[model samples]
Target: MFNMSGLDLMVIFKLAGIGLGTTLINQLLKKTDAGEWVFYTTTMGIIFGLLIVLQYVLQFFEAVQTMFTF
Candidate 1:
């Protein structure tokens, strides 16, 4: 059996929402011939997503450290 926390679920949802929003915006930008802005928007989305995940990764490392007591 595996245990999943609310934080994990939230992280997944947050990433998914970012991805969906980015895709939608990208499509809209393309349609409107604003291709130049698409790169910035996509980059911002990826950076934001990575920042969210980075917090969890740090927490995971701390937990592992405490578990091993080293």
Candidate 2:
């Protein structure tokens, strides 16, 4: 029951966008001498990305549990 949808592509794009955004901001902050903020920004980015995938991961596990339960 693997049905791919437009949302899957969007999620991938969103993750890619976050990665690019973080890299650019990291470089900009490094150049501007705002090194202290870099850690927070990168951590936030990782958190956001994880959040974006958490739902799907949970759903996948739930589906597996249900499939095997019955």
Lowest summed-lDDT stretch of 10 residues in model 1? 1-10
Backbone clash tally (model 2):
0
**Per-residue lDDT over 1-70 for candidate 1, one digit per residue giving the tens place of the 0 to 100 score:** 1124747577789999999999999999999999999999999999999998888778878777788895
Evaluate all candidate structures by whole-model CA lDDT and list the values in order.
Answer: 0.86, 0.86
Q: Residue-wise lDDT of candidate 2 within 1-70, one digit each (tens)?
A: 3234635688999999999999999999999999999999999999999998887777778768878995
Model 2 steric clash pairs: none
TM-score of 1: 0.83
Off by over 4 Å in 2: 1-3
